[model samples]
Target: MNTIHFTNLPDDLPVAENEEQKKQELEFLKSAFQTFNETTRHLQESYDKLQERLNALDLELEAKNLELEKNLQEKERVKNYLNNILESLTTGVIVVDKNTRITTFNKTAGIILGMTAGQCLNQPLADTGIQPLAELVQSSGGQTRMEDHEITTRDQRQVHIRLSASPVQDPAGHRMGTVLILQDITQLKRLEEEAQRNQRLRAMGEMAAGIAHEIRNPLGGIELFASMLKKDLAQDPEKRPLTEHIISGVKNMDRIISSLLLFAKSPEPSRQQCNLNHLLKDIVNASADFQCPDNVKIHHDLAVGEAVAAGDEELLRQVFLNFIRNAVQAMPDGGSLRLTTQTGNTADSRSHITVTVADTGVGIAAQDQKNIFNPFFSTKDKGTGLGLAIAHNIIKAHQGTIDVESETGQGTKFIIKIPAWDEN
Candidate 1:
């Protein structure tokens, strides 16, 4: 255990050394404080600038989001408006995918096709089983338009359609689908056929009139000479029979000339409102008394109570009488004759009177039907064939229509439609 002892020094000894050490220690503390305060101020300023920049970015983002939302709403509204327009169109529109499956079908398309959109949707064209549309699509070759194409429906009704097809494509020019437009032209086609028929009849009437005039001059002399010869042969029984035959031939020729004259000179209709049912009944009564065969029974079925039409009385009477006589003559082996009258509206919504004379006899052939109304065209083994030609002209002058429907071994029906008079 060693111990050492030290003596205490005076307070005033080595003052410079002590003062220098205290000054160095105080300066070090001041420098550290200044550095700490400067660092704290810089950190606070940096944090404030970062927060301001963040707030500005948030406002810009909100503006962009609002603009985007507005654009989306505008696009949605445009899409709805286009859809409405498409649905309102009268012409049929059909859209198909690349695989030939129907994608869109408008209301008119459904009506024209006789199928619903739901039934056709997402189904292949061949699967839809519409032969006309399928054939059209195949012939279209995905690029061309076909116009005025005629097709018969499932129910055997004929239709005229104008079709146009175009291929749908993406921005990259790849075909996406096909769009088809169909327009109905059935009524237009009917009107055209009527005009053509009328023209042909007019030409034939003119030609028949000229021929009749040429034959009449010689026919008058033949009739006069035959009558003189008949009087001379009154003394001879055998010669009298030959002269009678000559007279009968002259009378037949005169009747043919009269028929040709009637066909060529189309009289203007003096239209008056008349009871069509009563007129038809009178015609039937007259026919039964004289023209109609005793074996052919007549049936009157007037469904309409007040069947009336605007027409010339004399001309219409002739038309009805001719129809009845033809119907009675058709039934050589004793068939029934049905005369039906009714009031109905036409396709254009016009009220009209309709008369149908049907006969249960051997029907007319299809090839002969087309020429039945033409002058000098007849199947009957008789005198001239001008009865129907005259009848057609009379009906046409009265703004009426007469058509025939017949099938082999079935029966024959003649339909007459005349416009009704609006007394009001």
Candidate 2:
């Protein structure tokens, strides 16, 4: 407004200053670009390192997972394998933890103890209701391990058992629990006793046979003389009874001697297919011959199927006749008699023919039962006492077993098992 001047005024303005300002702005932009490039490079390097670390962790985790699964599978396989071995043992096996809790109970153990796994497993052994086993384990007077120890069951069956106990230990040898092994030996004991009895009887039989022969010679002469005397006294009626008494006494003595000889004899049984049902029926029908009373009732349950025995028919007839006669004699006051026949399996699962004779009568005493098969051990007031002994010997010869069960007043049962007739 006051009259402007043209052209170059001051060197500090416009051209030179503009050039310097542009130079400074270019330098600052360059410095800022370099700083941004360095920051981006550092960020990229850190991301690469983080990615590598994550990938390494995933691989380690995968391997660890595979090993864990493999260990789980191995453990399961071992558990099942152990379970199978525990189940198949015939001897009774019972395992209890340190806390006295039942951990394992096998099938044979269940059978012998008369209990099931559901009733015993995880329970206290003392509370499982097997008192004899518990007493043998827990009682101070009892032994933890013993052989051929005898005990009575709740069902009143006497059992012989061989038992052993051992400690269960962990892999580290720490006491974990106790394991008990048991075996039932009642049959073996009975067999041994029978063998001993047979040996004694054999010796007695040899002596009795000799004595019987000696007596028989004199007995025959006595009977012959009595008969002659009876003939001479036939006309004298007063002396007839005296000669009759002598003859009667001689006849009785002869009968006893015959019985003694019969008991002493043990012939090997002649085997034949004898239908036990038919044989028993015949004996029952002819029970009158054995003096079966009119007041006594007889019941028969013969098997519908064939119940055949492998023994001599004549011997079987005699054995059954003895049984029926003894049964009739036992029930003097009139009671029931039951005869049954069945084809079945024995304890070891062998085929057998069972003949049961049960009578409601005055039963034999428990003490007397132990000696009932011994010769000259009579239950009757007037008997030779050789019937049962002879019957026992005959059964043994026939490869059969005879057992008697009796109580003082309850009743008596005779069980006879013979080998079933096998064509093979």
In TM-score terms, which candidate is top?
2
What tens-digit string does per-residue lDDT give for candidate 1 at 1-424? 1222333434674878767756765676576667777777888898889889989989999999999999999999998898788888999999888878998888887776666888888899777665666666777776766656776654455568877888888899988888888888777876887689778878877888899899998888988898899898889998899978988988888888888888898768897987878888787675454566788998999965688889888888878888887877778898899989888899899999899999998889977887788777878899367778888898888878888999877789999999987887
Model 2 C-alpha lDDT per residue in residues 1-424, reported as the tens digit of each score: 1222233334565887878866766776676667777777888898989989989989999999999999999999998888788778789899888776899989877776667889889999888655655655554232246545776654566668777767777999887777778788888988898889899889888899999899989888988888898898889999889978887888888888887788888867899999998998887776455656798999989988899999988888878888888888888899999999988898888889989999998999977987889888997888778888889989888888998998877789999999999998
Q: lDDT at 313 for candidate 2? A: 89
Per-model TM against the reference: 0.72, 0.74
> Model 1, residue 291: displacement in angstroms?
2.9
Candidate 1, run of 10 with poorest lDDT: 1-10
> Each prediction's Cα lDDT score?
0.81, 0.82
* Superposition error at 147 for model 1 (Å): 3.6
Which 10-residue span in candidate 2 carries the lowest summed lDDT?
1-10
**Cα misplacement distance, residue 62 of candidate 2 (Å):** 2.6
